[model samples]
Target: MGSPNEMVYIVDDDSTVCDALSSLLRANGKNVRLFSSGAEFLSFERGDVGACLILDLRMPGMDGLEVQKLVSNQASIPVIFVTGQGNVPSTVRAMKGGAVDFLTKPIDEAVLLAAVEHALEKDRIARCEALQQADLLARYHLLTPREREVLPLLVSGLLNKQAAWELGITEYTVQIHRGNIMRKMKADSFARLVKLAGKLKS
Candidate 1:
């Protein structure tokens, strides 16, 4: 699950549009942070949490595309483009730039809400995968040298006798190291251990 404080950041120079969208989201039990411009939004600190950005495409100074580039470099924040007058070229640019959804104003409440939900869910899954990868790395780091040496062969479906022979150890010692590997990795089964190793490989 994402942090309870996770928000839908709304960046629009229009005060009315920002307020309306903020209120709409807040009414549906979503946390919101309203920013008057792209520059203002870029100043905020980000973390490994799930949230989406609703940005006006034609904002003054740094536009939405520029904001998307900046945010993409800093974190994997999904963007939704909102514009009063969207052109084909601009919409194409935003989509190619990794905007999850492009919305034109006056926004439909249901459509906007649905898009936000989808973006938030995507962010949630991404954050979870990142956390899982980090945990796997930490577990991998905890393995002893012998256990580490055994892991590749174990994940390759090697039997205890084969792994023992390959490592110049007895089958009994191979079994012992395998147990330690499983414990350190918090892996319950051979399949789980293989999956963890695959993630580490990636």
Candidate 2:
């Protein structure tokens, strides 16, 4: 079974190529979308989900590399470049630009499916990490100015008294801010708070 929430996008100028690739992916229980050109593909707004692009390397206008550039900022959609004749230069460029795989036509069914599976999984993990980063940022935004200042100090293993001295605040007040930081960050333990802080810094 496959979830429609996971999509496979095919962008090829040739209708025959598009139809064949779409059929193969659909047979594998994947939801497929087709486009005649990179412009068409980029214009369509995509939803947040697990998805990947099967891009034809050569096109009449705005080739695969151009499309890859357009979508480079979007981490949710991983890419696989398929060319009539895949070359070393193109393959190297695609890999450097973060394509999951570089494929040539007439493509092998098993290899294409494998690459698609890997791409879907990559997209899944990327989306998950992005969601987690967003959640962490939201939580961090809820902290007060003083709480924000104390977060790094306490996470750096400073004693409350030491932190109080650094900030020129009473230890009692530092303890109160520490409690607020713990609650605001929704951290169950100091270790978890430290981990969250590390993620934010990274």
Candidate 3:
């Protein structure tokens, strides 16, 4: 079972399979949502909260691979394929297309649960990193042009005097710019400033 904020999306044309999987997941205190087709699943708007998709490989119209293609741009939501007609080529294709796991039907309950847990945890981690990156970029954007100029030099291990010389400004002016950078970035110390700068560069 995952946190209340997490969700598991099941997309399969088979009513029996959808009902069974939904029952199993909800029995274990998980939040489950079901769709009868890949097109319906794709049309649904999902929240940014942690979520993963369990999709069937074969369907009437849009299949698992096609849905994977449509949703590939959404890097945060991972997918796991549950298919009765699994083959070597399809498994390879699913993995290559960035599915988190592939399970043949007559799906093992324990294995399916484990894969769901793993995918949800992965989504949590990716979302956390994305938030941190956005915060770093926002802080970086707050810097004055001169403060921005001073940041890379400080990260590169340049002394205030050397940075001042390079920018053709007084050392005192460089110190002011450095102070402003630190305050605006909310960096507690020199090491923290360096770390934020490294994140921006990466």
Candidate 4:
């Protein structure tokens, strides 16, 4: 599903840095939200917005890394860490914890813009995949027990006759179940059904 708006959330205790980054992002045609602390950022309603977090790693309470972990559990919003200290261990830790980019202080406008764009695109793609998965689950819920049993074999590339034999059912019955599965899934072709089955497997 597509979000109603795209926002770039800036979480930095430094008011000057927050204002500057907000101005720069707004000038570059992005919607921006500024939070003075990690706590403020965390408290916002998150799922409806298409956004990435620009977080300063050295905040006083609820530091950036902690915030990243919190957001990681809440949603798949991409994060770009901004740090004045630029310690290697912290950078590595942030990266390992799924921060999309680690940026240093005195941020380069071009690099920052590029990072924001990349994070937003990544979030968009992830949200789309999540939506697809939800749709797949809903379709799967509509399947009958027999259809569910036949689906795995069909997806294993078994022919109707083979699947029928394997399941100890008549070929006509297998065909009927297969037709029901295809209709329920809204899958127009066997290849599409296989793809859906692969998603379920994963």
Candidate 5:
């Protein structure tokens, strides 16, 4: 189930289509916004929430694929395309562009709801992972200069003596830095520290 704050953006030139989508999504406890054009949808600044886009493939000005390309670079809301013409090329392009699903009209209420659920869930997972990476980065920034210097070498399989030799420091000093790194990074074990190191490097 989605929160009441979770939004569904319906972008279509057809007023009737947008009205129908907004009604369906609102009835299922989702916040809905209707846009008459791709440009109008792009202009709206979305809040930080697990949201998805319902886009019409054909439009007078900027088409669905065009909007998708621009949105991918910015908003990154998951998309479910509803088109009267569900052609092969368009479907392949939308999928490759990271659309959640491509639906054909007359849209089945059940199928659209299922796609919306999947898209929202996917967005939530992505946002959660992003938050974790940000938290890890914050911890990494808390290390002192010497501790930072020692971290990579230790995680790279160097013993304290080896790391000390490489950095022209005493082995005891290296051991101290290692302890500090573990404490600052909140790593329960050396293995966990190594895993954190990998994420930072990547």
Candidate 6:
């Protein structure tokens, strides 16, 4: 069974295929959303929810690859492509676009289920990273201008006296700022503070 909050979105033009996939996923304690075309799926607002998309490679209006490109820049929902007439070129393009998996028509239920689980796990990890980054940024914004000035020098392996001289402040003032930065960033050690700075810089 997949996570209750995690959804599996299915976008295929064939009604029978969509229905069968939806039922199978739902029966296995997974949430499912079925779309008849890529456009319909794109129109839905999926903001920060952990989910994976099962997209058909060929469809009218907009194809799966087109949708994948668009979403890759947005929320980056993990994609698993399902195609009735998949070709080498198409599969290569999908893989390059960060697709989780590609399955041909008449896909085995076991294979499809495994792919969906993998995609959902990818989404979960991405969501966690996003949340952690947001938290780090929020903490960083709480820093004072002087603290911000001290941070780079501290992380760059500068001694307190050197950082104070660079910032035209007393060594005692630099130590005070360092303590504040550590407390505000919730970093327990000098190494952890350096790591947090790296994440912020990246």
lDDT of 4: 0.92
Candidate 3 or 2, higher TM-score: 2
Q: Per-residue CA lDDT of candidate 2, range 34-100, in tens? A: 9999999989988876899999999998999999988886544789999998889989999999999
Any runs in candidate 5 off by more than 4 Å, and if so which?
none
Which candidate number would show the highest lDDT if scored against the true structure?
6
Candidate 3 residue-wise lDDT, 1-202, digit = tens: 5687899999999999999999998988889999999889888988766888999999998999999988887555889999998999999999999899999999999999999988888888888999999988998999998899999998899999999999999999999999999999999999999998888978
- Pairs with backbone N, CA or C atoms under 3 Å apart (clashes), candidate 6: none
lDDT for each candidate structure: 0.90, 0.92, 0.91, 0.92, 0.93, 0.93
For model 4, residues 1-202, the per-residue Cα lDDT tens digits are: 2234888999999999999999998888898889999999989886587898999999997999999999888878899999889898999999999999999989999999999999999988998988999999999999988899999999988999999999999999999999999999999998998988899877
Query: What is the clash count for each candidate, in the order shown?
Result: 0, 0, 0, 0, 0, 0
What tens digits encode model 6's per-residue C-alpha lDDT throughout 1-202? 7776889999999999999999989988899989998888888887556799999999998999999998887768899999999999999999999999999989999999999988999988898999999999999999998899999999999999999999898999999999999999999999999999999988
Per-residue lDDT over 23-48 for candidate 5, one digit per residue giving the tens place of the 0 to 100 score: 88888888888999999999998887
Displacement of the residue 20 alpha carbon in candidate 6, Å: 1.2
What root-mean-square deviation over C-alphas does model 1 reach?
2.4
lDDT of 2: 0.92
Instruction: Return the TM-score for each candidate structure.
Output: 0.88, 0.96, 0.93, 0.93, 0.96, 0.97
Task: Extract clashing residue pairs from model 5.
Answer: none
- Per-residue error for 138 in candidate 1, Å, reads 1.8
In model 4, how large is the Cα lDDT of residue 143?
96
> C-alpha displacement of 141 in model 3, angstroms?
1.7
Residue 175 of model 6: what lDDT?
95
- Assess the local accuracy of residue 9 in candidate 6 as a C-alpha lDDT between 0 and 100: 94
